[model samples]
Target: MVKPTYSPRRRTGARANAPSSQRTLHLGGESNPGRIQPSTKAAPIDTMPITSDPALEPLHRATLRVIGKSPGTGLVLPQCHIASCAHVVGRGTPPGTELRVQPWGRQPVEVRLIAIDDNADLALLGPPVDAPCPVELQQLMPLPLDGQIQRGDRFAAIGFPKNTNTQTIQCEEIQAEYEFYTHRQNQPSLLKLKLGQFRPGFSGGGLLNLRTGRICGLVKETRDEYQNLGGRAIPIEDLIAFCRHAGLPLSHAEPPPAVASEQAQALAAFLQQLPKWQDLASRRLFVQWALLNHPHAGDYQPMGQNPAADAQALALATLGPGATDAGLDAARQLLQRVLEEPVGKATKAEAKRLLKLLDA
Candidate 1:
């Protein structure tokens, strides 16, 4: 397996040879001002070893065993073991070199080079020996359209944090903000997480949903105090892009085309059978799910008397208190259609009421 190397851009004049005492004397100074300071060249960063406890061994091994399968392939796994002080070395090494990752517990796993996005501190990993692939890549869950993640959600972190032998599995209630910034198109959005502990080895672990076991975010970083300092996970959407780029299989096992097609038909049929009141909510949920899990679903098209126009009108009428200014603008466009319609007095009255609330 080839390890990935990060070669930072060579800094100009940053590697000059040390000046001898004679040379220093010639400059009329005891120390050479041009010489790099020892502090500047000290070992990249100090890493702390997580305390070894027998209880954590299985979790650590389990995570490593699963992630270690693809030695040099850069597919990010749900379970990641991070050293206390691993620095993000830029792409400085040769392409095929096996990158040595020194996790806390077991032996160093030779990770194959996959892909590394320096801005995101995310690196894709291939399967390792004895590492079982997750049922899915964990990132296919639907994001709530409202963009709200409440506190107290149950979450788990799987990683080989300390060592290979120490599988420290940790689960906790989410408390603080999992603040995140994205630079995909130079447009950054702050995503806050609602759960989990930011333990040392859990850097690349998945922040998974307790209900469906789907992944919500990639474990990025945590606050130092572990108090209100919340841990951050990369959203699943980003993970999908990363995996696709790395060419890793999206699911642990591939299903036959017939089976997949049948599943899709069944879902559509089921939705069609729903009651009228349930239709909108069900369709909305389906649309959100399709957006993440089935990108091929095409764009969302509302259906009804006015179809797209009515859907937009409803969305405008129901803007939540937390709606942003941009969201409000979108609602206005939709509501305008409702106002322009020729309707009975009762219907028109209701529309006027909604428009009034929106204007307020």
Candidate 2:
């Protein structure tokens, strides 16, 4: 991959769980540790609360419409004419490849590609002009792994639909799996929005976690019946891995930094050592930690009933919590032995989970 040339701001080495810098101060002389007052400058008490209303937020308000025209004899060409589109695509592309949309009765305006995931039909565009408050990329959050996402779980879709200048809004819950596809064919997860207000031009928007506001997926398509389909967001963990592999800076808002090859060497060494340990307890913890921290493409279910499950259960039981540190070490060694054998071992599910845990 060609290296992205931008530099990123260096992150201060803060603990992952530390409080954010945007801490609010409380009035009235005293405050609870758990509750802080909003900053006075945030919003007036009498005015509408933008934070609570997704539509009111500047990010939600901004939208990018991908306008395309099909030449009679060739492929369709896409144009980013919307205001938000221009904001996101600014100065990001090479001279000729920069996105330009010809507005009615005027010359074309320039836009830049903020990011693009071709497999997901998602591309973030930036306007050529700057704004006082730029839209921020939402943080990735965790999802339930052991269960199915059911109907009625509230969700929000953000995107510029119908190649318009402003974003079309819709908040709703999953009605059902409107469609499904294999992983090889661009597995798009289709969702039915509660509100019946989805349209074209809303592709490449984000579907966010209602409670935490983290981005869970990228909106790719919407049916006239208000069915929303999206590609799951690239897991934060995977993003980190890709960045490391490509020697790109994790922070993108700033300039790029040099990455030493030693970091990659260290990561490879860690992965190599993981399967060699004998203790099951330690291995289990490590595996669980990996799954919890990583964003996977989908659930980790092993196939069918058989020795795979047995082997996995045995391995897990051998390493389950509370095993002595030494016992755990032993279990890890045994699991390695089991993995080495081609057949006659744990159920497929168990093996799959184990392998996934290790990969994560």
Candidate 3:
């Protein structure tokens, strides 16, 4: 993996968490945390609030503050085990490296690294037999492994940062969007999320599902800062595998039943008519309403017998990266209807840009 450079800037408003100048997430391209502009819109505030839930309060105790020059974060799990990022504690820093963790409301305790999954960027820690009881991790039920994480699902993360006051840990709640799946890549295919500003200590903690208040996955790394290329997590399935590999016992909440094929097909049918809704707002709102009504039914997968392919082409043409000439042409062809007809200025401008990208 390529390394990313972090350029420092003058400290901004309240210093809740300090940015790491050396530590950076390598995701194929240059990711400068300083390049991300502050967002004006509070998507989380507009959508839903996760801070009020007492169920998530236990997460604070589970969060662990690493005390060092480049202090990071970790979370407590069952069986006196602590989970964190391998990179945070030094991936190749040899086994049994001495580390100190300040558990919530407790004195600093010495712990040693026991296991590290380099591929998943996960590490497990356990205290010496003589050490005090570690903070108890909440065994909240997890979202089903087979369930789909949609475009606008909300989640919260709790972590200890060196920049913040040692007494108080901050819990940041944000609305996350599922961007894409990368299967052929070096890393495992993860559900990439788009979130608001998160601090350095946010790493190594767990990404909690807001609705279920369960630890969905470990917060792996953050990408292009605030441009919606937020952070990545070791999706729930991968997290389970890591736990099993480390011989940790975990109790999962009963998963909801599989989404029926008929329902998925019907939702696909409804989304296909979005283009025919006469206006972009109506089309977008209609799709949103359908998803709102059938939250369980996942996004329509492209198939031979369905209109999913056309819908995908239209979507890809309009919003996706025109990486290839053929893809650009296909996008241009699909977007011609909107361009020719009076859909709206914004829609027409987007269509023209897609076409221009193809020409370029």
Candidate 4:
């Protein structure tokens, strides 16, 4: 898929060679730089071979196997919206192409494409035009508003893994885990999936975090990492951004107060104030400000050093002397993540940068 251009004007020059995914563009009046666009590329299709239990019946039932020229999976959402990988219903698909969806144990029914975000590798689908959805929907999957996942967290992906020519997919539930974020050149934003084995046909299926029993992502593709095979997934943050940009309803809920408080503590107040914790621009601004503007001048408080906004000193004053390394280290790592891989300043619009800053 071509990289989505956020610029309001139509791209010319070498960009003309790239396929257009922005089916709907806002070109007049106010300009938005962070504006997300559509895509026209498709990925190889696959299924998330996961077994179902009584507790996971809702997820299994709500998950759908999308039938296009090829098959893929889709997740049912509130308000009759269906979320899936953009490639499953790529903009390049034939206009007259008939699409159908079949929930677990339910009959296949017609569906229509509504919108796509190639930038985010996400697509939104609805019931057939001028027709209502007739499927017996199950409990819609919910997204954790914070979109946080710790390494090694237990995960169970649910969707229809495919079968072809009499080959079968393992129908047993297996362990999967969140490992790391992967940013490959010219590839869609992705999260690394740590799993042993998976059969094909999982694309567009929900990546369920077993600990929270909530979907944290959608399985995108399988990857061969070194000799160890693994999987790739779209992050929940991208899904959230897609919903926000496409005007689709998002089913999300915040983590518990204690969990949020812990996450906040794991981050520095400076970074915590940013909308996306991993946003390079916002973090860069804060880092630059701390280095040049803050009284501390980028250094932690030392004996006889300026203690402006010094939390270590305050903690010592209140809780007595103790190791505060964990919190400070976590904050440093959070900052390092963005600084190491910044979205180039020359590439993004300043207004959109400010909006991300202001959104915090």
- Which candidate number would show the highest lDDT if scored against the true structure? 3
Candidate 2, residue 315: lDDT: 35
Local accuracy of candidate 1 as per-residue lDDT tens digits, 1-360: 122222221000001111101000010111211121122221211121232333322222323212321211111343432211112223332223334442322233354445555554556553344554222222212221111122223344444322222222222223233233323353223233433345444455555443323445555566452544455555544555445555543322221122212222322333333333145654454334323332222222233443334333233222332334443444444335435645456555654555565566
TM-score of 1: 0.40
TM-score of every model versus the real structure:
0.40, 0.33, 0.52, 0.57
Q: How many clashing residue pairs are found in candidate 1?
A: 47
Q: Compose the digit string of candidate 4's lDDT tens values, residues 1-360.
A: 223332111100000011101011111111111121212221112222233344454456457666643346787776677778777666565333456665443335567776676556677777766776553443344344335454345565554444332222212232455555666666555767665343345667777776667777777776752322557778766676666556665646675432223223323333333354345454444434333322221122222222223333222211222223333333333344445545444223432433243335
By summed lDDT, the worst window of 10 consecutive residues in model 1 runs over: 20-29
Window of ten residues with lowest summed lDDT in model 2:
11-20
- Number of the top candidate by TM-score? 4
After superposing candidate 3 on the true structure, give the runs of residues whose Cα lies further than 4 Å from its correct spot: 1-55, 129-148, 162-175, 225-229, 257-360
Residue 335 shift from truth in candidate 4, angstroms: 14
- Candidate 2 per-residue lDDT over residues 196-294, each given as its tens digit: 333443343444434333333334334443433322222222232233333333321221232323322332233334432234454444344333332
lDDT of 3 by residue, 105-178 (tens): 34455777767766667777777546664432222112222223433345566654333232233435334544
State each model's CA lDDT, in order.
Answer: 0.34, 0.30, 0.49, 0.47
In model 4, where is the ten-residue run with the lowest total lDDT? 11-20
In the order shown, the candidates' Cα RMSDs to the true structure are 17.1, 16.6, 15.5, 16.4
